[model samples]
Target: MCELLGMSANVPTDICFSFTGLIQRGGNTGPHKDGWGITFYEGKGFRTFKDPQPSCDSKIAELVQNYPIKSRAVVSHIRQANRGQVNLENTHPFTRELWGRYWTFAHNGQLTDYQKLNTGHFRPVGETDSELSFCWLLQKLEQRFPEPPQDMEAMFAYVAECCDELRELGVYNMLLSDGEYVMTYCTNHLYWITRKAPFGKATLLDEDVTINFQEETTPNDVVSVVATQPLTGNETWHRMKPGEYNLFHFGERVGGNVDELADVAFAEAKPKSQAPTEPL
Candidate 1:
Protein backbone atom coordinates (compact mmCIF):
# COMPACT_ATOMS: atom_id res chain seq x y z
CA MET A 1 0.00 0.00 0.00
CA CYS A 2 1.00 3.65 -0.42
CA GLU A 3 1.22 6.27 2.37
CA LEU A 4 -0.42 9.67 2.66
CA LEU A 5 0.52 12.97 4.34
CA GLY A 6 -1.62 16.09 4.60
CA MET A 7 -1.59 19.43 6.39
CA SER A 8 -4.14 22.15 7.11
CA ALA A 9 -3.30 25.26 9.03
CA ASN A 10 -4.74 28.62 10.05
CA VAL A 11 -1.56 30.28 8.87
CA PRO A 12 0.91 29.53 6.13
CA THR A 13 3.18 26.74 7.37
CA ASP A 14 5.87 24.43 6.00
CA ILE A 15 5.84 20.63 6.42
CA CYS A 16 9.58 20.03 6.38
CA PHE A 17 9.83 18.19 9.69
CA SER A 18 6.97 15.76 9.14
CA PHE A 19 7.98 15.31 5.51
CA THR A 20 11.50 14.41 6.63
CA GLY A 21 10.10 11.52 8.63
CA LEU A 22 7.66 10.46 5.90
CA ILE A 23 10.25 10.48 3.09
CA GLN A 24 12.31 7.99 5.08
CA ARG A 25 9.46 5.52 4.84
CA GLY A 26 9.81 5.57 1.05
CA GLY A 27 12.90 3.39 1.41
CA ASN A 28 14.84 3.61 4.65
CA THR A 29 12.21 3.16 7.36
CA GLY A 30 9.57 1.19 5.46
CA PRO A 31 8.72 -0.26 2.03
CA HIS A 32 6.92 2.47 0.06
CA LYS A 33 9.72 3.10 -2.44
CA ASP A 34 8.04 3.26 -5.87
CA GLY A 35 7.57 7.07 -6.10
CA TRP A 36 6.61 10.21 -4.18
CA GLY A 37 4.67 13.43 -4.80
CA ILE A 38 3.58 16.46 -2.79
CA THR A 39 1.22 19.37 -3.49
CA PHE A 40 1.14 22.65 -1.55
CA TYR A 41 -1.74 25.10 -1.71
CA GLU A 42 -1.08 28.86 -1.46
CA GLY A 43 -4.28 30.80 -2.07
CA LYS A 44 -5.41 30.03 -5.62
CA GLY A 45 -1.90 28.94 -6.54
CA PHE A 46 -0.31 25.55 -5.85
CA ARG A 47 3.07 23.90 -6.34
CA THR A 48 3.87 20.23 -6.61
CA PHE A 49 7.06 18.17 -6.73
CA LYS A 50 7.23 14.55 -7.72
CA ASP A 51 9.70 11.82 -8.57
CA PRO A 52 9.25 8.28 -9.79
CA GLN A 53 12.10 7.09 -7.60
CA PRO A 54 12.63 6.21 -3.99
CA SER A 55 12.10 9.39 -2.02
CA CYS A 56 14.81 8.52 0.50
CA ASP A 57 17.44 8.78 -2.23
CA SER A 58 15.80 11.14 -4.72
CA LYS A 59 17.38 14.58 -5.08
CA ILE A 60 13.90 16.05 -5.45
CA ALA A 61 13.05 14.81 -1.99
CA GLU A 62 16.23 16.42 -0.71
CA LEU A 63 15.20 19.74 -2.22
CA VAL A 64 11.79 19.43 -0.54
CA GLN A 65 13.55 18.93 2.79
CA ASN A 66 15.75 22.00 2.45
CA TYR A 67 13.37 24.40 0.72
CA PRO A 68 10.48 25.81 2.73
CA ILE A 69 7.35 26.53 0.73
CA LYS A 70 4.71 27.59 3.21
CA SER A 71 1.09 26.76 2.44
CA ARG A 72 -2.29 26.50 4.16
CA ALA A 73 -3.11 23.03 2.84
CA VAL A 74 -0.87 20.26 1.53
CA VAL A 75 -1.31 16.74 0.10
CA SER A 76 1.56 14.29 -0.29
CA HIS A 77 2.06 10.62 -1.06
CA ILE A 78 4.75 7.96 -1.29
CA ARG A 79 3.77 4.93 -3.26
CA GLN A 80 4.51 1.22 -3.28
CA ALA A 81 3.39 -0.06 -6.64
CA ASN A 82 0.25 -2.16 -6.65
CA ARG A 83 -1.96 -1.56 -9.69
CA GLY A 84 0.09 1.12 -11.42
CA GLN A 85 3.62 0.92 -12.81
CA VAL A 86 6.45 2.93 -11.24
CA ASN A 87 6.18 5.87 -13.59
CA LEU A 88 5.68 9.64 -13.26
CA GLU A 89 2.11 9.39 -14.66
CA ASN A 90 1.15 6.78 -12.11
CA THR A 91 2.16 8.87 -9.09
CA HIS A 92 -0.35 9.82 -6.42
CA PRO A 93 -1.64 13.27 -5.46
CA PHE A 94 -3.55 13.43 -8.74
CA THR A 95 -5.08 16.81 -9.47
CA ARG A 96 -8.32 17.84 -11.26
CA GLU A 97 -10.39 20.95 -11.81
CA LEU A 98 -13.84 20.98 -10.24
CA TRP A 99 -16.16 23.85 -9.37
CA GLY A 100 -13.48 26.25 -10.61
CA ARG A 101 -11.13 25.09 -7.82
CA TYR A 102 -8.19 22.74 -8.05
CA TRP A 103 -8.89 19.51 -6.19
CA THR A 104 -6.05 17.24 -5.15
CA PHE A 105 -6.40 13.70 -3.86
CA ALA A 106 -4.15 10.89 -2.60
CA HIS A 107 -5.06 7.37 -1.59
CA ASN A 108 -3.22 4.84 0.56
CA GLY A 109 -5.29 1.75 -0.02
CA GLN A 110 -6.21 -0.51 -2.92
CA LEU A 111 -9.66 -1.19 -4.29
CA THR A 112 -10.92 -4.39 -5.85
CA ASP A 113 -13.73 -4.36 -8.45
CA TYR A 114 -13.11 -0.64 -9.04
CA GLN A 115 -13.32 -1.00 -12.80
CA LYS A 116 -17.09 -1.07 -12.51
CA LEU A 117 -17.09 2.56 -11.39
CA ASN A 118 -17.98 5.02 -14.14
CA THR A 119 -16.90 8.56 -14.88
CA GLY A 120 -18.43 11.22 -17.16
CA HIS A 121 -16.17 14.25 -17.32
CA PHE A 122 -13.37 13.15 -14.99
CA ARG A 123 -10.88 10.67 -16.37
CA PRO A 124 -7.70 9.05 -15.12
CA VAL A 125 -4.39 9.53 -16.90
CA GLY A 126 -2.89 6.56 -15.12
CA GLU A 127 -3.75 2.90 -14.52
CA THR A 128 -4.05 3.04 -10.73
CA ASP A 129 -7.26 2.26 -8.89
CA SER A 130 -6.56 5.27 -6.68
CA GLU A 131 -6.83 7.69 -9.59
CA LEU A 132 -9.86 5.89 -10.96
CA SER A 133 -11.62 6.21 -7.64
CA PHE A 134 -10.75 9.92 -7.45
CA CYS A 135 -12.14 10.56 -10.89
CA TRP A 136 -15.35 8.74 -10.06
CA LEU A 137 -15.73 10.80 -6.90
CA LEU A 138 -15.48 14.11 -8.74
CA GLN A 139 -17.73 12.90 -11.50
CA LYS A 140 -20.44 11.85 -9.06
CA LEU A 141 -20.21 15.13 -7.17
CA GLU A 142 -20.68 17.01 -10.40
CA GLN A 143 -23.68 14.91 -11.34
CA ARG A 144 -25.34 15.58 -7.99
CA PHE A 145 -24.57 19.25 -7.53
CA PRO A 146 -23.74 20.45 -11.07
CA GLU A 147 -21.90 23.22 -9.29
CA PRO A 148 -20.64 23.46 -5.71
CA PRO A 149 -23.49 22.87 -3.31
CA GLN A 150 -24.83 25.65 -1.16
CA ASP A 151 -25.47 23.38 1.79
CA MET A 152 -22.02 22.23 2.79
CA GLU A 153 -23.15 19.86 5.51
CA ALA A 154 -25.41 18.09 3.06
CA MET A 155 -22.64 18.09 0.50
CA PHE A 156 -20.17 16.42 2.87
CA ALA A 157 -22.77 13.98 4.07
CA TYR A 158 -23.16 12.99 0.46
CA VAL A 159 -19.43 12.65 0.17
CA ALA A 160 -19.45 10.37 3.16
CA GLU A 161 -22.10 8.25 1.51
CA CYS A 162 -19.94 7.96 -1.58
CA CYS A 163 -17.01 6.89 0.55
CA ASP A 164 -19.14 4.34 2.30
CA GLU A 165 -20.08 2.87 -1.02
CA LEU A 166 -16.45 2.76 -2.09
CA ARG A 167 -15.57 0.88 1.10
CA GLU A 168 -17.64 -2.05 -0.12
CA LEU A 169 -14.84 -2.93 -2.53
CA GLY A 170 -11.85 -2.69 -0.18
CA VAL A 171 -9.74 -0.32 1.89
CA TYR A 172 -10.29 3.34 0.89
CA ASN A 173 -8.24 5.57 3.17
CA MET A 174 -7.73 8.91 1.41
CA LEU A 175 -7.10 12.66 1.68
CA LEU A 176 -8.73 15.29 -0.55
CA SER A 177 -8.65 19.07 -0.64
CA ASP A 178 -10.41 21.80 -2.64
CA GLY A 179 -7.95 24.57 -1.79
CA GLU A 180 -10.30 25.70 1.03
CA TYR A 181 -10.80 22.54 3.05
CA VAL A 182 -9.40 19.03 3.42
CA MET A 183 -11.56 15.91 3.72
CA THR A 184 -10.08 12.73 5.16
CA TYR A 185 -11.68 9.31 5.09
CA CYS A 186 -10.39 6.26 6.94
CA THR A 187 -10.87 2.58 6.33
CA ASN A 188 -7.89 1.30 8.25
CA HIS A 189 -5.03 3.22 9.94
CA LEU A 190 -4.78 7.02 9.92
CA TYR A 191 -3.61 9.48 12.57
CA TRP A 192 -3.59 13.22 13.11
CA ILE A 193 -1.98 15.76 15.45
CA THR A 194 -2.72 19.42 15.95
CA ARG A 195 0.01 21.82 17.09
CA LYS A 196 -0.89 25.18 18.53
CA ALA A 197 0.46 28.10 20.58
CA PRO A 198 1.86 25.99 23.42
CA PHE A 199 3.85 23.82 21.04
CA GLY A 200 6.77 21.80 22.32
CA LYS A 201 9.77 20.00 20.94
CA ALA A 202 9.21 16.70 19.15
CA THR A 203 11.55 14.13 17.66
CA LEU A 204 10.94 12.20 14.47
CA LEU A 205 10.24 8.50 14.72
CA ASP A 206 12.25 7.59 11.60
CA GLU A 207 15.02 10.18 11.94
CA ASP A 208 17.23 11.48 14.76
CA VAL A 209 16.27 15.11 14.13
CA THR A 210 14.51 17.15 16.83
CA ILE A 211 12.78 20.50 16.52
CA ASN A 212 11.10 22.94 18.89
CA PHE A 213 7.93 23.99 17.12
CA GLN A 214 7.27 26.72 19.68
CA GLU A 215 10.24 28.65 18.36
CA GLU A 216 8.98 28.53 14.79
CA THR A 217 5.30 29.34 15.29
CA THR A 218 3.43 32.38 16.58
CA PRO A 219 0.94 32.33 19.45
CA ASN A 220 -2.07 32.40 17.13
CA ASP A 221 -0.86 29.70 14.83
CA VAL A 222 -2.69 26.39 14.61
CA VAL A 223 -1.49 23.62 12.35
CA SER A 224 -2.83 20.12 11.86
CA VAL A 225 -1.11 17.16 10.23
CA VAL A 226 -2.58 13.85 9.08
CA ALA A 227 -0.55 10.83 8.05
CA THR A 228 -1.07 7.13 7.37
CA GLN A 229 1.00 6.58 10.51
CA PRO A 230 2.16 8.80 13.31
CA LEU A 231 5.27 10.62 12.12
CA THR A 232 6.55 11.52 15.58
CA GLY A 233 7.02 9.12 18.46
CA ASN A 234 6.89 11.93 21.00
CA GLU A 235 3.57 13.43 19.89
CA THR A 236 0.20 12.03 20.94
CA TRP A 237 -1.62 11.54 17.68
CA HIS A 238 -5.35 10.80 17.48
CA ARG A 239 -6.12 7.72 15.46
CA MET A 240 -9.18 7.53 13.23
CA LYS A 241 -11.28 4.41 13.23
CA PRO A 242 -12.49 2.49 10.22
CA GLY A 243 -15.68 3.88 8.60
CA GLU A 244 -14.87 7.35 9.94
CA TYR A 245 -14.35 10.61 8.08
CA ASN A 246 -13.27 14.07 9.12
CA LEU A 247 -13.22 17.44 7.41
CA PHE A 248 -10.65 20.06 8.31
CA HIS A 249 -10.36 23.75 7.47
CA PHE A 250 -7.68 26.14 8.64
CA GLY A 251 -6.16 23.51 10.96
CA GLU A 252 -9.44 22.80 12.75
CA ARG A 253 -11.76 19.85 12.41
CA VAL A 254 -15.05 21.11 11.06
CA GLY A 255 -16.96 17.92 10.29
CA GLY A 256 -17.01 14.20 11.02
CA ASN A 257 -18.98 11.16 9.86
CA VAL A 258 -19.95 7.80 11.25
CA ASP A 259 -21.66 5.51 8.75
CA GLU A 260 -23.77 3.94 11.47
CA LEU A 261 -24.31 6.80 13.89
CA ALA A 262 -27.96 6.00 14.48
CA ASP A 263 -27.04 3.37 17.04
CA VAL A 264 -26.70 5.06 20.42
CA ALA A 265 -24.18 2.54 21.73
CA PHE A 266 -21.99 2.92 18.65
CA ALA A 267 -22.11 6.73 18.76
CA GLU A 268 -19.81 6.63 21.78
CA ALA A 269 -17.40 4.22 20.14
CA LYS A 270 -14.83 6.81 19.06
CA PRO A 271 -13.34 9.98 20.46
CA LYS A 272 -15.72 12.97 20.54
CA SER A 273 -13.25 15.75 21.18
CA GLN A 274 -12.98 18.07 18.19
CA ALA A 275 -15.96 20.13 17.06
CA PRO A 276 -16.83 21.40 13.61
CA THR A 277 -14.94 24.65 12.96
CA GLU A 278 -16.92 26.11 10.08
CA PRO A 279 -20.01 25.60 7.89
CA LEU A 280 -17.91 24.22 5.07
Candidate 2:
Protein backbone atom coordinates (compact mmCIF):
# COMPACT_ATOMS: atom_id res chain seq x y z
CA MET A 1 0.00 0.00 0.00
CA CYS A 2 0.96 3.62 -0.55
CA GLU A 3 0.34 6.78 1.48
CA LEU A 4 -1.54 9.76 0.06
CA LEU A 5 -1.61 13.46 0.91
CA GLY A 6 -3.73 16.27 -0.49
CA MET A 7 -4.59 19.90 0.10
CA SER A 8 -7.24 22.41 -1.01
CA ALA A 9 -7.32 26.03 -0.02
CA ASN A 10 -9.44 29.15 -0.57
CA VAL A 11 -6.25 31.11 -1.29
CA PRO A 12 -2.99 29.96 -2.82
CA THR A 13 -1.29 28.01 -0.01
CA ASP A 14 2.01 26.17 0.19
CA ILE A 15 2.00 22.58 1.51
CA CYS A 16 5.56 22.65 2.83
CA PHE A 17 4.38 21.98 6.37
CA SER A 18 2.42 18.82 5.51
CA PHE A 19 4.87 17.70 2.86
CA THR A 20 7.63 17.79 5.43
CA GLY A 21 5.83 15.18 7.52
CA LEU A 22 4.79 12.97 4.57
CA ILE A 23 8.32 12.73 3.19
CA GLN A 24 9.52 11.27 6.46
CA ARG A 25 7.19 8.31 5.89
CA GLY A 26 8.69 7.69 2.44
CA GLY A 27 11.80 6.18 4.04
CA ASN A 28 12.83 7.62 7.38
CA THR A 29 9.88 7.29 9.72
CA GLY A 30 7.80 4.73 7.85
CA PRO A 31 8.09 1.87 5.31
CA HIS A 32 6.68 3.43 2.13
CA LYS A 33 10.11 3.74 0.51
CA ASP A 34 9.47 2.58 -3.06
CA GLY A 35 8.88 5.98 -4.74
CA TRP A 36 7.08 9.29 -4.43
CA GLY A 37 5.38 11.99 -6.53
CA ILE A 38 3.50 15.24 -6.08
CA THR A 39 1.26 17.46 -8.21
CA PHE A 40 0.44 21.13 -7.70
CA TYR A 41 -2.44 22.83 -9.46
CA GLU A 42 -2.02 26.49 -10.37
CA GLY A 43 -5.15 27.70 -12.10
CA LYS A 44 -6.15 25.35 -14.90
CA GLY A 45 -2.52 24.26 -15.39
CA PHE A 46 -0.58 21.96 -13.09
CA ARG A 47 2.97 20.71 -12.59
CA THR A 48 4.14 17.38 -11.17
CA PHE A 49 7.41 16.07 -9.72
CA LYS A 50 8.19 12.38 -9.48
CA ASP A 51 11.14 10.36 -8.30
CA PRO A 52 11.62 6.63 -8.30
CA GLN A 53 13.86 7.01 -5.27
CA PRO A 54 12.68 7.15 -1.71
CA SER A 55 11.48 10.66 -0.87
CA CYS A 56 13.69 10.95 2.20
CA ASP A 57 16.82 10.57 0.06
CA SER A 58 15.66 12.42 -3.06
CA LYS A 59 17.26 15.80 -3.70
CA ILE A 60 14.14 16.89 -5.52
CA ALA A 61 12.12 16.27 -2.40
CA GLU A 62 14.50 18.45 -0.44
CA LEU A 63 14.11 21.26 -2.96
CA VAL A 64 10.34 21.02 -2.73
CA GLN A 65 10.58 21.13 1.04
CA ASN A 66 12.48 24.44 0.89
CA TYR A 67 10.56 26.10 -1.93
CA PRO A 68 7.11 27.40 -1.14
CA ILE A 69 5.09 26.76 -4.29
CA LYS A 70 1.67 28.12 -3.42
CA SER A 71 -1.30 26.57 -5.18
CA ARG A 72 -5.06 26.10 -4.83
CA ALA A 73 -4.94 22.30 -4.89
CA VAL A 74 -2.28 19.63 -4.41
CA VAL A 75 -1.97 15.82 -4.44
CA SER A 76 1.00 13.67 -3.39
CA HIS A 77 1.83 10.01 -2.88
CA ILE A 78 4.53 7.74 -1.47
CA ARG A 79 4.52 4.22 -2.80
CA GLN A 80 5.32 0.90 -1.15
CA ALA A 81 5.31 -1.10 -4.44
CA ASN A 82 2.43 -3.52 -4.20
CA ARG A 83 1.58 -4.10 -7.88
CA GLY A 84 4.35 -2.36 -9.84
CA GLN A 85 8.11 -1.98 -10.08
CA VAL A 86 9.97 0.80 -8.28
CA ASN A 87 10.50 3.16 -11.20
CA LEU A 88 9.61 6.65 -12.33
CA GLU A 89 7.02 5.32 -14.78
CA ASN A 90 5.16 3.67 -11.88
CA THR A 91 5.14 6.65 -9.57
CA HIS A 92 1.85 7.94 -8.17
CA PRO A 93 0.05 11.28 -8.51
CA PHE A 94 -0.65 10.63 -12.19
CA THR A 95 -2.02 13.42 -14.42
CA ARG A 96 -4.15 13.57 -17.58
CA GLU A 97 -6.09 16.25 -19.41
CA LEU A 98 -9.89 16.14 -19.42
CA TRP A 99 -12.46 18.64 -20.63
CA GLY A 100 -9.71 21.19 -21.29
CA ARG A 101 -8.63 20.95 -17.66
CA TYR A 102 -5.88 18.87 -16.09
CA TRP A 103 -6.89 16.17 -13.64
CA THR A 104 -4.51 14.76 -11.03
CA PHE A 105 -4.92 11.50 -9.14
CA ALA A 106 -3.12 9.57 -6.39
CA HIS A 107 -4.22 6.36 -4.77
CA ASN A 108 -3.44 3.93 -1.96
CA GLY A 109 -4.24 0.19 -1.57
CA GLN A 110 -4.09 -2.69 -4.05
CA LEU A 111 -6.87 -4.09 -6.23
CA THR A 112 -7.49 -7.51 -7.72
CA ASP A 113 -8.45 -7.90 -11.42
CA TYR A 114 -7.86 -4.21 -12.15
CA GLN A 115 -6.50 -5.22 -15.56
CA LYS A 116 -9.99 -6.26 -16.59
CA LEU A 117 -11.15 -2.65 -16.60
CA ASN A 118 -11.28 -1.26 -20.13
CA THR A 119 -9.68 2.12 -20.70
CA GLY A 120 -11.01 3.83 -23.79
CA HIS A 121 -8.93 6.83 -24.92
CA PHE A 122 -6.92 7.30 -21.73
CA ARG A 123 -4.19 4.72 -21.29
CA PRO A 124 -1.70 4.05 -18.52
CA VAL A 125 1.95 4.88 -19.13
CA GLY A 126 2.99 2.50 -16.37
CA GLU A 127 2.01 -0.93 -15.09
CA THR A 128 0.91 0.17 -11.64
CA ASP A 129 -2.66 -0.62 -10.65
CA SER A 130 -2.84 3.00 -9.49
CA GLU A 131 -2.29 4.49 -12.96
CA LEU A 132 -4.56 1.98 -14.64
CA SER A 133 -7.35 2.79 -12.20
CA PHE A 134 -6.87 6.49 -12.91
CA CYS A 135 -7.10 6.00 -16.67
CA TRP A 136 -10.19 3.81 -16.38
CA LEU A 137 -11.90 6.43 -14.24
CA LEU A 138 -11.20 9.21 -16.74
CA GLN A 139 -12.46 7.03 -19.56
CA LYS A 140 -15.71 6.47 -17.70
CA LEU A 141 -16.17 10.18 -17.06
CA GLU A 142 -15.54 11.03 -20.71
CA GLN A 143 -17.99 8.38 -21.81
CA ARG A 144 -20.59 9.85 -19.48
CA PHE A 145 -20.00 13.47 -20.50
CA PRO A 146 -18.17 14.34 -23.69
CA GLU A 147 -18.03 17.91 -22.47
CA PRO A 148 -17.97 19.46 -18.99
CA PRO A 149 -21.30 19.29 -17.20
CA GLN A 150 -22.97 22.38 -15.77
CA ASP A 151 -24.42 20.31 -12.92
CA MET A 152 -21.33 19.73 -10.79
CA GLU A 153 -23.22 18.03 -7.98
CA ALA A 154 -24.55 15.46 -10.42
CA MET A 155 -21.05 14.94 -11.75
CA PHE A 156 -19.69 14.48 -8.22
CA ALA A 157 -22.38 11.96 -7.43
CA TYR A 158 -21.47 9.99 -10.54
CA VAL A 159 -17.83 10.05 -9.47
CA ALA A 160 -18.76 8.65 -6.06
CA GLU A 161 -20.70 5.86 -7.72
CA CYS A 162 -17.70 5.02 -9.86
CA CYS A 163 -15.50 4.95 -6.78
CA ASP A 164 -17.94 2.64 -5.05
CA GLU A 165 -17.56 0.21 -7.92
CA LEU A 166 -13.78 0.31 -7.62
CA ARG A 167 -13.99 -0.10 -3.86
CA GLU A 168 -15.78 -3.36 -4.45
CA LEU A 169 -12.60 -4.77 -6.02
CA GLY A 170 -10.41 -3.81 -3.03
CA VAL A 171 -9.39 -0.93 -0.84
CA TYR A 172 -9.63 2.23 -2.96
CA ASN A 173 -8.73 5.24 -0.86
CA MET A 174 -7.95 8.05 -3.30
CA LEU A 175 -7.43 11.76 -3.89
CA LEU A 176 -8.52 13.28 -7.21
CA SER A 177 -8.75 16.85 -8.41
CA ASP A 178 -9.32 18.87 -11.58
CA GLY A 179 -7.52 22.02 -10.28
CA GLU A 180 -10.80 23.39 -8.86
CA TYR A 181 -12.38 20.69 -6.71
CA VAL A 182 -10.66 17.99 -4.68
CA MET A 183 -12.54 14.73 -4.36
CA THR A 184 -11.70 11.99 -1.90
CA TYR A 185 -12.98 8.49 -1.21
CA CYS A 186 -11.94 6.23 1.63
CA THR A 187 -12.22 2.49 1.85
CA ASN A 188 -9.90 2.13 4.79
CA HIS A 189 -7.65 4.70 6.44
CA LEU A 190 -8.07 8.38 5.60
CA TYR A 191 -8.21 11.57 7.65
CA TRP A 192 -8.73 15.29 7.00
CA ILE A 193 -8.30 18.62 8.81
CA THR A 194 -9.62 22.06 7.91
CA ARG A 195 -8.26 25.36 9.25
CA LYS A 196 -10.13 28.62 9.02
CA ALA A 197 -10.49 31.73 11.19
CA PRO A 198 -8.81 31.62 14.62
CA PHE A 199 -6.00 29.57 13.23
CA GLY A 200 -3.82 27.74 15.71
CA LYS A 201 -0.44 26.04 15.91
CA ALA A 202 0.15 22.52 14.63
CA THR A 203 2.93 20.04 15.38
CA LEU A 204 4.02 17.43 12.88
CA LEU A 205 3.96 13.89 14.23
CA ASP A 206 6.77 12.56 12.05
CA GLU A 207 9.13 15.49 12.58
CA ASP A 208 10.09 17.89 15.34
CA VAL A 209 8.56 20.89 13.61
CA THR A 210 5.76 23.26 14.52
CA ILE A 211 4.09 26.15 12.76
CA ASN A 212 1.92 28.92 14.09
CA PHE A 213 -0.66 29.22 11.33
CA GLN A 214 -2.10 32.40 12.78
CA GLU A 215 1.16 34.20 12.11
CA GLU A 216 1.41 32.86 8.59
CA THR A 217 -2.22 33.06 7.50
CA THR A 218 -4.87 35.74 7.38
CA PRO A 219 -8.13 35.46 9.32
CA ASN A 220 -10.11 34.69 6.14
CA ASP A 221 -7.82 32.02 4.78
CA VAL A 222 -9.35 28.54 4.70
CA VAL A 223 -7.07 25.53 4.18
CA SER A 224 -7.84 21.83 4.25
CA VAL A 225 -5.53 18.80 4.17
CA VAL A 226 -6.25 15.09 3.69
CA ALA A 227 -3.93 12.17 4.32
CA THR A 228 -3.89 8.44 4.82
CA GLN A 229 -2.97 9.18 8.46
CA PRO A 230 -2.98 12.14 10.74
CA LEU A 231 0.00 14.38 9.91
CA THR A 232 -0.22 16.60 12.96
CA GLY A 233 -0.12 15.11 16.45
CA ASN A 234 -2.01 17.90 18.17
CA GLU A 235 -4.65 18.77 15.58
CA THR A 236 -7.91 16.84 15.42
CA TRP A 237 -8.21 15.17 12.01
CA HIS A 238 -11.62 13.95 10.97
CA ARG A 239 -11.45 10.29 10.07
CA MET A 240 -13.59 9.43 7.07
CA LYS A 241 -15.74 6.31 7.54
CA PRO A 242 -15.39 3.32 5.27
CA GLY A 243 -17.24 3.77 1.94
CA GLU A 244 -17.34 7.51 2.53
CA TYR A 245 -16.85 10.10 -0.24
CA ASN A 246 -16.06 13.77 0.14
CA LEU A 247 -15.68 16.79 -2.14
CA PHE A 248 -13.77 19.85 -1.07
CA HIS A 249 -13.78 23.25 -2.76
CA PHE A 250 -11.90 26.25 -1.40
CA GLY A 251 -11.11 24.31 1.79
CA GLU A 252 -14.77 23.61 2.63
CA ARG A 253 -16.57 20.30 2.43
CA VAL A 254 -19.41 20.85 -0.04
CA GLY A 255 -20.53 17.34 -1.00
CA GLY A 256 -20.20 13.63 -0.32
CA ASN A 257 -21.81 10.91 1.87
CA VAL A 258 -20.82 12.48 5.16
CA ASP A 259 -22.27 12.32 8.68
CA GLU A 260 -23.36 15.83 9.66
CA LEU A 261 -23.31 15.05 13.37
CA ALA A 262 -19.80 13.63 13.20
CA ASP A 263 -18.65 16.76 11.42
CA VAL A 264 -20.20 18.88 14.15
CA ALA A 265 -18.45 16.87 16.84
CA PHE A 266 -15.10 17.27 15.15
CA ALA A 267 -15.69 21.01 14.90
CA GLU A 268 -16.40 21.20 18.60
CA ALA A 269 -13.23 19.37 19.70
CA LYS A 270 -10.67 21.67 21.29
CA PRO A 271 -7.18 21.91 19.86
CA LYS A 272 -4.15 20.98 21.93
CA SER A 273 -1.45 23.31 23.21
CA GLN A 274 0.79 25.09 20.74
CA ALA A 275 4.47 24.43 20.31
CA PRO A 276 7.28 26.79 19.36
CA THR A 277 7.05 27.87 15.73
CA GLU A 278 9.71 27.42 13.09
CA PRO A 279 10.18 29.03 9.66
CA LEU A 280 9.33 26.87 6.69
Name the best candidate (by lDDT): 2
Global CA lDDT computed for model 1: 0.85
Overall local distance difference test of candidate 2: 0.88
The clash numbers for all candidates, in the given order, read 1, 0
Per-prediction TM-score: 0.91, 0.94
lDDT of 1 by residue, 217-277 (tens): 9989988888888776656677788888888888987888742223222111221222222
How many backbone collisions does model 2 have?
A: 0
User: How much is 9 displaced in model 1, in angstroms?
Assistant: 0.4
Which portions of model 1 miss their true places by more than 4 Å? Answer: 258-280
